[model samples]
Target chain A: MNRQIHLVERPKAAPTHEHFNLVETSIPKLGDQEVLIHNLYLSVDPYMRGRMSDAKSYVPPFKLNEKLVGGVVGEVVESNSDQFQTGDVVTGMLGWEEYSIAPEKEIRKVNPELAPVTTSLGILGLTGLTAYFGLIDICQPKEGETVVVSGAAGAVGSVVGQIAKIKGARVVGIAGSDEKIDYIKNELGFDEAINYKTTENIQEALEKACPNGVDAYFDNVGGEISDAVLNLLNKFARIAQCGAISSYNKVDDQGPRIQTKLIKSSALIKGFIVSDYAERFKEGAEQLGQWLQQGKLKYEETITEGFENIPDAFLGLFEGNNLGKQLVKIGEPQHAKL
Target chain B: MNRQIHLVERPKAAPTHEHFNLVETSIPKLGDQEVLIHNLYLSVDPYMRGRMSDAKSYVPPFKLNEKLVGGVVGEVVESNSDQFQTGDVVTGMLGWEEYSIAPEKEIRKVNPELAPVTTSLGILGLTGLTAYFGLIDICQPKEGETVVVSGAAGAVGSVVGQIAKIKGARVVGIAGSDEKIDYIKNELGFDEAINYKTTENIQEALEKACPNGVDAYFDNVGGEISDAVLNLLNKFARIAQCGAISSYNKVDDQGPRIQTKLIKSSALIKGFIVSDYAERFKEGAEQLGQWLQQGKLKYEETITEGFENIPDAFLGLFEGNNLGKQLVKIGEPQHAKL
Candidate 1:
């Protein structure tokens, strides 16, 4: 019997493991156009917090008493569709369950010979494409420009800093802890790192670190830290707002006031949902995969074991517990490193 | 002797009438590439408020203790170049004084036979160009797209609403009073009008007024009212932030939080200083002039008499006291209607 976790209710704050219940059932018979996936890994992201609530967002909110869905990597156990075969590894929107049945149109079969399947959820997935498009298409980072990334240790922020560095821009990463700072600077090769938790004066730190003023700001956290970054932006600066992790989990409205700073600096602040660029997803993925193969791109994943731990893994992202891509180890690692 | 005002000290807040001191001096000597103009009408605008402050803004701040500079229409008193002759009416950044001298490259000679010289400072000048570029270039307002303009009773905002209407979009204007609101909708041909002061609930009014949600929001006031409009924006909504009249004069450092709404709605909020698009100024001016000649665009001016009243005229913009193009009738209207 395959056990699957189903959502019992919508969570108001940090979702505990108890918000879901594990139910054992026989896997549903695959339709003529459907394939059954034996889940190997499931992604836990900060954006999932928005889905957990019934409030209107970019996408429809998660329904109560329904399975919570996110990005997942798995191997096809059985396929009735001609597009996919049994034993074929694939990735798509799979809920936190041991098994998933999706139509051929919904999943993309990964070529394991090209890269690890987990990378499908990180560097080669929505996170990578988001960073690629947000930095290149939105901010259009110029050479020698100063780029600042907030929530620098997270999936999207991590890649944004790396892409900015690759573009020959000075990269500054703002994270929650010293460890995350080291990961952003030492491991990820950011030019400078600021530990937002320990810094007494964010404005002073930004001035000391970014003397030239921030030309581009990739905002992942929207709060006082964003306010500090706002003050440090140069005239006609570009701000690519990919996420607001710091305020995502807040029950009350506590984000800092930043409209005045934007006006004063004549800045361009744009917020984008990655799925809006689905037509260009292939272009982003192909370029990112080449970068990874050439050793020009790097990624990290904080994996929590077991399918039941999906909620906790997601909650950990808001608490700044994960260093990079937050994921739940649903089954076993299906693909060996190339 | 033709006297001219020079650059003066930057003001921290609302500039007083005393901030600009009248000085007596010989008309500036024009070199081979220069033209001397006897000042006629001086234009006062909201953008000059930013230039008065020493803060790093889009345009360089005004230098201390000198006559302030702005767009003005005057008559050429002397010409040292072939571009203009004495008695030719011209308009450019001719400072606030009785007389001025500018490089021939800076002045654009206007023919009173085509239109009034003061019209060059209003409908055919920076205010007109700002509306054309900020609407057509930045907002890219398509035909039938719902367009909303704040500060719609003022210069740029008034022109912006009318242009959007001419483009076939359902235009809504927000003004401070019922009379202004009536003027915007009835006289300007806007689809709807909102008296922001009398409206108890802005969000509800926006919902009822703009039932389809705004496609392009031409924001002149960036505060609570704009924030309310943000929530009603559809996906891919474009916000052209031209001014922040709501918070410009407020001494407090607080305004509504707008980033979160922008993120959830996947909106684009951009701030623009009109002069940045100087390359397109000629095209804009020509188009605006045609629009005026065809009677497709109409503009009104709140002409305050005398040089001493310039500060009061400018300050009136923040309070929404001016009807349309706020200008001081400095000296006399040199190029009058025949």
Candidate 2:
């Protein structure tokens, strides 16, 4: 039997469990060039929130009363393609179900011997590439320059801070909790971390943290936090507008106009997603892997153990409940040995 | 005696006539490498509004009770250096007075025979250069792409539209008056023009004008108009944020958050002043001159006579009263021929 989660209703603001439905069905058969896989892990992300809305966006919105799809690592239980075999581990966009049928072209085999299989979904996958390209290609932080990143404790932000450090920039991170502050500062080698939840005055805290002024910004959370960083920008500051998780749930988010601020600083703000740099993924992935092997990069994951808890893990992202990449451990590989 | 305008008080919101005071004083002697200029044309621009207040910006705030300084086209009535001679027409940053002193390095000779001397302050100078760099370098509008420019009948916006046409892009202009709309579309050859003041729904009008969607936007007025343009951006759209003239007088300008729109389109927004491209000014000036001489580019100037009218001309900018470049004719050359 297969249990799959489906979007039953569109969310106007914050998503709740009522918007989703879990349906049980029999496993499907595989066709030519297709493989049947028993799911091992499912990745949940903040950007997924955008897919729940029926708005014009980079990608099309998820359909109602249908199986929801996302990144997944699973083991092939049956194969009708020569490229994939039984007992092989792979990763691709698959349904949020216990058993998934994947066309050969839609999935790629993951070599567990290279690193942990979960790393294929986190540190070495889209999350890490997002940090790499958005930081290196967009922001381009220079040596001794100050780089500020919002959502500093999350998956992409954690990797962004580490990469900025590697580029010799003075990294200042803004996160919600003291634990996230300590983790990014002490564990991730960030120069400074601000607990935005406890900081009575964010502008004052940012000024104190970035005394030399911000030259580059990686914005995951936008709102007053972004406004504060914008106020302290040096001339020619570059901002990688990666995400606006802060305003993603709001119907109408209003703030101070930023045109004057951008003009005064002669700054550049570029909004992008990881797939925009799809052609250079190999180069980025190789570099991130090398950094990991050399102990120059580190990562953490908050894994929820059951498929039933997938919605909770996704919802927790908005509340700042997860540190690093958030993933759900579905089922153990039935036919694969690791 | 020399006549001058001074900022008597800083304006909290919109500047009024009371904020300025006309003063009279005797002209001073010139030192070595100095020349005395008989002011002919004084350029009153929108950017000067920022200098009136004590806010930190690209340029320093105007000092209280001091002579206002700006771009001037004048004659060298007295010279103390070999670099300049008496009767030589020159243009530089000079005081708003009938007689003013300038060092040899501060002023550069303007060839009246090449074009009109007034062109030195309008088309063949900073105004043209601002349009050139902001459009070609920042927006980089490709052929067949649709380009929209706000403040499209003003000095910089007019030139930006012409240049976009020169680059083979479909140009759509937004302005305040129907006369200005007729001018940009009929005379200047813009593909379409919208009289934003009379347009019931700017977004719907823009949709009709730019059926291909907006690939590039040169934003001079940043408020509701910019919000409308931002909503219609195509994938990878580029916005040259030159000025926010619409919000200059508002103490606290508020508007819809744009981060999500930017992310949805994977667009880029860069704010700049002409001086940011000072190194390439000569290249920009040469191209503009060639275009103007070849009859590919056209310009208009609304000349307000007399130095005393400088404040009125400056204030008229906020009301959108000027057709193109706003200049106050202070005095004619007493020692030079055209």
Kindly list the interface RMSD, in angstroms, of each predicted candidate in the order they appear: 2.2, 0.7
TM-score of 1: 0.94
Candidate 2 reaches a DockQ of 0.88
lDDT of 1 by residue, B200-263 (tens): 9988999899988888999888788887888888888888888886666555546445666677
Candidate 2 local lDDT, B186-295, one digit each (tens): 99999999999999999999999998889999999999999999989999999999999988999999999999899999999999999999999989999999999999
**Candidate 2 local accuracy as lDDT?**
0.93
- Residue B259 of model 1, lDDT score: 63
Off by over 4 Å in 2: none
Which tens-of-lDDT digit does each residue in A221-297 have in candidate 1?
88888888888878889998888876665676544445556767778898888988889998999899888988988
The number of the candidate with the highest DockQ is: 2
Candidate 1 regions exceeding 4 Å error are: A9-26, A251-260, A333-338, B1-34, B333-338
lDDT tens digits, residue span A224-326, model 2 = 9999999998999999999999999999999999999999989999999999999999999999999999999999999999999999988999999999999
How accurate locally is residue A145 in candidate 2, as Cα lDDT from 0 to 100?
99
Chain A TM-score, each candidate? 0.95, 0.99
The true-versus-predicted C-alpha distance at residue B266 of model 2, in Å, is: 0.5
